[model samples]
Target chain A: MTRRWFLHPHAQVFLSVLLSAASQVLFKKSAPMSADASPFGFAAMSSGWAWLAALATIGSLLAWLYALRFVPLGVAYNLSGALHVIVPLSCWIFLGEKIVAQRWLGIALVLAGVLVTAQSAAKIEETIEKEIEEKP
Target chain B: MSPFAFALIFASIALQVGGQVFFKLAMNQTHAGRTARYVPALAAGVAAMTLSIMLWIGLMSKFPLSQLYPYEGIERVMIVASAALFLREKMTPRLLLGVALICGGLILVTAS
Candidate 1:
């Protein structure tokens, strides 16, 4: 394995998040046709979308695995909320779909919340590290 | 898609978006029904999926879930702009304003 495999706890989490974002973008780019449109479609049609989705789902599972190593489950789960904002906006923009102004505002609020949460976590980590260093 | 949605839910959201992109491309082709028409798009989707799984595995191995979760907000911002640029979608001024507000709020929150 490479040296990078042994990343700091925080960095690992960051990587996972970055990958998750990438997965979402790619998944959005690769979807198959609708079920309603394909009356005679086999499992392959579903698999096309399912497989791509599986990649993202696997990303989440991996994130969960990494997260368990350092951060509390509650915190990790909370961070996953960011996907709520990212996924929809991506759809609206890339799919040529419409999103109302009010919904946009909601997305902003959620982003704000996430930032606040992250800041709090950083502070907590620092405090914890300092206390540990002071101990004999 | 509900941002709260996780795992399968999130995946479904991505698939829907990806599907639409493919549909649009397929429509533009002379033989829309031909499997060949969708190959590129399908390939792109699969690539995306694979990347996601890899990233998730890496993340699960290292961080506290809480700390990393917030990055999703940043991802959202990226998606909006990317979609507009790549998909030729229109972003209303109000939406842009909303994005700006969110960005500002996120900055403040993180700075604290």
Candidate 2:
């Protein structure tokens, strides 16, 4: 029962976003701001955390592609907005990062926008399918 | 931020959007049984994604993550717009409102 749920396409989308947030946090941790941290340099590649971050990124991309097979790009893409919330929260909890009240408000707005976008995407997809069926 | 910084941000987002669109196109082609076209589409998608990562890494190295992340919201908006344009995805008024709210929120986050 548990295994099947993990294989669900929507579940994959959720997993992808979670992994993406994880990767971002890991990357941020591995690459501290420094004079040698040039734009094109690979200095961070020396860190074990950086490699794990890369692996997470690759895993997220693969999960995303698998989900895309079943979900419309529009819907799946909008759902990814959850990253805005997840990444910030992860940083706060795991890294002892501080988010200001204003940023928290902004995060709330982003969550609302994600819900709105998701609702519209699903409705539009249904209408499009109906239109195609009615055409001929 | 400098104009050049803005340009780099724009470029990174565009490349990522291009990557996603290509991947969707590849999937659509597969479903349509145009399998021969799939390889090129997938290849293009990978190339675009790789370039976007390189650019993103460069941006991350230059700027703080807090300052850089708001641009991710902007990237989502761009991706949705491109999906409508390239993938024949229809955009509704509600979708537009949602995207607007997201952009506004990101702007606020940046301000904060």
Best-performing candidate as measured by DockQ: 2
Q: What are the chain A TM-scores for all the models, listed individually?
A: 0.64, 0.81
- Per-residue lDDT over B1-112 for candidate 2, one digit per residue giving the tens place of the 0 to 100 score: 6797788888888889999998888866765656697889889998999888877776777787789988887788778888888888877777777777777778888999
Model 1's DockQ score: 0.04
Residue B65 CA displacement from its true place in model 1, Å = 24
Q: Which candidate achieves the best TM-score against the true structure?
A: 2
Give all candidates' CA lDDT scores: 0.47, 0.79
Please compute DockQ, using alpha carbons, for every candidate against the native two-chain complex. Answer: 0.04, 0.52
List, residue by residue over A14-84, the lDDT tens digit for candidate 1: 55655565555554444333423221223332445446655665665455444434443333333544654
User: What DockQ does predicted model 2 obtain?
Assistant: 0.52
Candidate 1: CAPRI quality band: incorrect
- Candidate 2, residue A74: the lDDT equals 69
In angstroms, give how far residue B18 of model 1 lies from its true place.
28
lDDT of 1 by residue, B34-85 (tens): 6576667646655654444444333322332222344444544555555566
The TM-score of predicted model 2 comes to 0.87
lDDT of 2 at A132: 32
The TM-score, computed over Cα atoms with residue i paired to residue i, of candidate 1 is 0.42
